[model samples]
Target: MRAVPRPAILGSIAAVLFLACVAPEDRGTDATNLRDPWAIRAEPGDPALAAGKEIFASCASCHLADAGGRSDGTIPRLAGQRAEILEWRLRGLQDGSIDLPVMTPFARALTEAEIRQVSAYLASLPRPERIGSASGGVNERGAKLYHDRCRSCHSAEADAVAASNAPRLCGQHEAYLLRRLEDMASGNAGGAGAARAVDPAMEAIAIALSMEDRLRVSRYLARSECD
Candidate 1:
């Protein structure tokens, strides 16, 4: 992990404590609309950016201070994500459209302004180097599976994450990818309470793969280069 300045880190921690003391009314309303993520563009060092960094202290535990997330893929890299995508996903989580175990409630805790601010902060950071495969080496079977099943959307170069509005697979952690695939394949990847177009699309794709294929593809992606 990259070393961060102690003061900045401490300030972020303090912000978390401050947010805790804020009453429900002071916390502001939950984010409900994702259609206008660019409603506020906060540059680094701006007041919005500063506030966002402070509020993000609570998230650092899981996402890491640099937002590099875990190399094992249990969490995703938040750094370098598009602000629009972050806003959209957070809104979905806040409203229960996306039903992650921890993120659901975590999203609920933030006000709309804080969410946009943090999203801006995350988008400002540089993307990390590829995490590489947990399996130690590329598996040909996995590569083949990706070519046939995933390449259309992810692209052969695997650099179309933002263009496709899909998650970054290249440089992602294998274990995390594996677990998510398992969940999607098993029809347990969230939105269990109601139907949503996004949830079903992924599930349909995952359902076509056997467990072995899923493992192979995930490992292949974990080791693949983004360029």
Candidate 2:
């Protein structure tokens, strides 16, 4: 047997020790991939999601390596969310119907195939925990508020009416929907209604909501209802 250099022998021993102590997923990353201080291990591969993985490259830039959203809440969550809903939103984006400036570029940049790929990947990821199921949470006042103020423009299509560009509210997360409502109340959601800033009625809807009233209404909307 040949004698190994002492320093080389010690280095090899150290490398083996590190691997033994490391988790399986932490191997094989390069420096660029390591740029994000928050990189993490994703769940085990789902053979079905292989397609989405390839398509999601564009979105991974903003949504992050993990489906988890950013701290500022600027981007909506896509992971673990309903696939159909995500597809519809993407379709809206691709078709140039949704208004937010930030999203316009993303929609325009992605191809139909790419959209399907990314949307599929996002759908396969897990949903946010804040999206809890609706139970005993209906409030008559909120329902009436939705009907009287919101229904004219929003129309009646499940919890949310997307036909009039009102957006379907069914299956939306309680916390997310509520946060949106709060934003609307405080001049935050930006668009008024339908055609993005054309509906003045949305202001009335926002005004009707007192802090508690808005909350109750939000909870009622969260209480899963049939379209």
Candidate 3:
């Protein structure tokens, strides 16, 4: 497994598990919107922001200076993300529900203002340009996989929206894609209450994936537009 970042590493695992059982309604982000994530409140050369920048140095390791997520998706992209969303997730990582080994220390050291600063810093960064499948090649395979196994409810691109509680797979991270699949396949994860799209007996969907194919499909999905 990859090294967890600071204390927040465990938060990733916890988030998934919590998300598995969390009602969709409860998952709402704390921030209003992220269209201009940094505009909530701040001034150029704000002193608190400067302090937040110093504190945010640690977060940069996994989140990247741009606040974009890990290429493998171990961490979700933070740039342009909703402020409340970022705060909520950070709080989740710090308090429990989210399991991040590294973030523990990080969170412990932070003050509310620091958190806001970091959130602002992340929001201020430019959003990444997401990418996805090359062409018909990967999509063909993904399509086959979707219909034969995933299509009962998750319609095309795993985007059934209201029909199912499952998350949209269109612009998800490829690395995260692989990890979630593995977790589901292992039966260690649970989201059935939220995802009627997955058939009761469909646990084998993970087993159906070959190592190579799984990687390929995930990469394709990750590259798609998330905006």
Going through the candidates in the order shown, the clash numbers are 0, 6, 24
Off by over 4 Å in 2: 1-50, 53-99, 117-137, 152-162, 190-199
TM-scores of the candidates in the order shown: 0.68, 0.49, 0.53
TM-score of 1: 0.68
On residues 1-227, what C-alpha lDDT tens digit does candidate 3 reach at each position? 12334336323322342123232344453223323322445566777557656655666776666555665556655555445345544555566544445445555455677567766665455566654223233455765665576655444554322322334455556666676666556664433322322233444666678776666666666555534
Predict model 3's lDDT versus the native.
Answer: 0.50
Candidate 2 TM-score over all chains jointly: 0.49
Each candidate's lDDT (Cα)?
0.58, 0.44, 0.50
Q: What is the C-alpha RMSD of each candidate to the true structure, in Å?
A: 9.5, 18.2, 7.6
For model 1, residues 1-227, the per-residue Cα lDDT tens digits are 23333233322221111001111122233334223433348765788888767767766777778877676655665566557656655665566544453444556666788667877887677667646436757799999888887777666855433333454457666777787777667765533542231435556778998998888888888788765
lDDT pick, better of 1 and 2: 1
Q: Residue 23, candidate 1: how far off, in angstroms?
A: 36
Worst 10 residues of 2 by lDDT: 15-24
For residue 160, model 3's alpha carbon misses the true position, in angstroms, by 14
